[model samples]
Target: MASLELRNVNKRYGQGQADTLKNINLSIDSGEFLILVGPSGCGKSTLMNCIAGLENISGGEILVEDQPISGMSPKDRDIAMVFQSYALYPTMSVRDNIAFGLKMRKVPQARIDEEVERVAKLLQIEHLLHRKPSQLSGGQQQRVAMGRALARRPKIYLFDEPLSNLDAKLRVEMRTEIKLMHQRLKTTTVYVTHDQIEAMTLGDKVAVMKDGIIQQFATPQEIYNSPANLFVASFIGSPPMNFIPLRLQRQGARWVAVLDSGQDRYELPLSVEDGQSLEGREVILGIRPEQITAANEGGPALRAEVQVVEPTGPDTLVFVSLNEVKVCCRLAPDAAPRAGESLALQFDPDRVLLFDANTGERLSKAPEHIPAGQSGNIAQFAAR
Candidate 1:
């Protein structure tokens, strides 16, 4: 396996056109799985194409194992890519398809046969080795495509939404299989997917991209728990982080956010230092749905009128209004209240996040620390 790095890489279609990939810098360690995740037209595919040498980078360097490869052709890059379309030849049997790459490199017929059988067994498709692409299911076709890549044993593997075409159940199955295969082979891999679940589950590191720029590059948990910007926070979660727009108010020495739910006002503590700059400034209170829950006995609570209740089997999402903004709270199915019911909701103050309303950037400083509460109001809120 080889380590791959992109240094200030830029891509553009025309001389004067805006770049499709802008000043990209990333490194994937050997035997590591890196996920490039973003929405459509976010340049993730373009970045993958650049790495695979299918698209020429407009500026900067692409390196494999610390050796520059920007000038090399795709075949010489020593990378194997599984396309979104599977791209298996319709007329070729699974064995031939898997062996095609080795054969092109002039590998002996016996070696090709052995490699084909090995990958077929590895992918659990040994029984379908003689079947053509047209005769197999979509999931089966995807495995064959993967087998083709595996047979070559390239320095790195590039998976471009390899599971996009599979059904939901099959996608989950294939995801597990891919993880297992990677665990056994320990090959360096770069995966591009629009699915956040796949991004969170499959990668050792994740790069969240948008409009040709990487917004955040970190571990999945870091990306989830401490997103760099509002866009990253809003994009990574399943139900999405709830953004409550409100103005900050200082209560003695602490900066607190006030929430109004039509019935009453609640003061949520902030971790930022005591400063006049944030006082009266508009900011978004960013909290995950899972972070909000039914108030524990005598714990901090906000009286909210439930507007909607959506039961999603294992958990129920409770929607309520705070500061005139709708907020979603994930609660245990058994404890979830119905619509129109008045419930006391509690938030985890330590887990609460703040973002600049206008800039969409996180407001707190790095290595955030929570200070002691300076007001009786905050204590009362915590007790209620």
Candidate 2:
């Protein structure tokens, strides 16, 4: 196991050109899993390649266990990478594939055989060891690729969208398998993916990237509940956070947000202590679909016509027009109203978030955290 760190890392293609990576800084503790996630063209893969020594950094250092490795060749860096394509030699049996790396380093054949068996059993692929890559299922082949990397038993393991090519069901399965494998091996790992689900479920720390800049780097829970910027808030959720443009209104001693549905209006109370800075300003109010529910306690309620209803098994999504924008409300499937039906929606004030209108930076402070396994809704959506 090893710790990884990048200090003021910078990458550029040529002189006078925009940097591919800009002042990137991150640290991962030994045996921790770190996921780098963002949309395509977000420099996640570029950053991963840089860490793997496939691309040299323009400035700064890459360290493994506190030792600088910026000038080391990929082979010398003691990192094993599992590529997205599951790069297996077509003619080699799974056993040979798993042992190829050890053989290249001239580990004795007996030792190579022992190492191959260890990872094959570890990956639960012993039954398929004699099969060629062409004979195994996508998930099985992915295991072989993983076994290859695991055989090296390097200081750090790098996975670049290793599950991207699998079917949705298989992808979910592989995700669990990978998580279990990490738990067992306890090796330092760096994973790059565009999938938010993977980022939320797999990482001890997640770095959300955009335009070659890291938007936020924190635990999955922190990123979900207290994203540093609007992009991070918008990127890490499943149903995505709901954004409504609003002008803050002062109701004497308190600040509030005006939410209008054209049918009815709601003055959702704000938790701002610095109301003087926000009063009457056009900032964005971000509420998660789950936080807006069927009115019950009558705290902050609004009446809106249901524009659309979508049933997604576990919960139904109810859509309505609010403040001239479409807003989604997550509801129990049995509780959802039909389209065109009038629905009374309620807001959870403590869970609401505010963002600066122009800068897209978070304006609200992170809310107090409830202990884990207490609050179930991720729709609290960047409240912190």
Candidate 3:
């Protein structure tokens, strides 16, 4: 395994056309699992291709183990990639396919046999060694692609959405398998995906990219709790954060956000630090759906009629209208209210985030760094 570094990397197809990848800089330690995630046309695949030498950068350098590899050819770079298409030889048996790379490298027959056996057992595809790619399932084909790469024992492994074509259940299973494989092999890896679940669960560090630029580079937890901008916040979460547009007001000495539910007006006390006076300034209050609860706490509660309720196995999603906006609240299945019923919703003031309405930049101070694997903040909204 080797560390991978990219400095000021830029990519462009032509002189007049726009740059495909902006000045991108990133560092990955040896044996790490780094994920590059974003929507389509975000330049994630371009960056991956650059690292593997399939596409040369217009500027900057790519290094492996502190040595420059930017000028090297794809074969000389020694990076193995598992493509989404599972580009396997249809006529070649699984064993032959796995051994093909070693054959190209002219490794000893005995060593190639041993590597083939090892990765087959590692990927649990030993029984299909004699079968051709046409007889194998999609997941099996993907495993063979990965096995072929593993047999190379390169400095880095690049996975370009290797599971994108699989079914939902198969994708989850393959995700677990990949994570376990990484743990056992401990190979330095660069994975590119558009799946949020994969981005959050599989990577040790995640880089959220958009429009040919890196938006945020940090741990999954850090990106979740303290997003640098509104785009990062809106992109990473599953249900997504709710952006409530309102202006802050100073109720005497403290800053408060006034919420109107068409029936009652509730003043939400906010914590403003660094002497940042936000009175009479319009901003977006960004909070997760899970942050808003049905529990009636005394701090400040808004009375709103439940517009809809959806039971989703472990949790219930209840919808309500606040300030002419539809708000969703995730609550316990047993505590959920039916449609048209009045419910007192409470907000966690400290956990609430703020963003600039016009610029989409984070305006409120981010919460303290949440330790990995720890639950988020406890609400100060006490029951009356």
The candidate that wins on lDDT is: 2
Please list all clashing residue pairs in model 1, or write none if there are none: none
Error of 2 at 162 (Å): 0.5
Per-candidate TM equals 0.94, 0.94, 0.93
Model 1, range 1-384, lDDT digits (tens) per residue?
999999989999998888898888889899999999999999999999999999999999999999999999999998999999999988898988999899889999999988988898888999999999999999999999999999999999999999999999999999998998889999999999999999999999899888888887877887888777788899999899999988888888787888889997789987775443886788888999999999998987999999999999999999999988899999999998989999899888788888888877776542444222211111211221
RMSD of each: 6.6, 4.2, 5.7
Off by over 4 Å in 2: 297-300, 366-384
Can you tell me which runs of candidate 3 are displaced by over 4 Å? 297-299, 364-384
Error of 2 at 325 (Å): 0.6
lDDT of 2: 0.88
Off by over 4 Å in 1: 366-384
**Tens digits of per-residue lDDT for model 3 on 1-384?**
999998989999989988888778789899999999999999999999999999999999999999999999999999999998989998899999999989999999999999999999988999999999999999999999999999999999999999999999999999999999999989999999999889999999898888887877787887788776778889988688888899988877777888888888888887765478676777998888899997566656788889999999799998888788888889889998889999998888887888877767676462343445332111110100
On lDDT, the stronger of 1 and 3 is 1
Q: What's the true lDDT of residue 279 in model 3? A: 64
Better of 1 and 2 by lDDT: 2
Taken over the whole model, the C-alpha lDDT of each candidate is 0.88, 0.88, 0.87
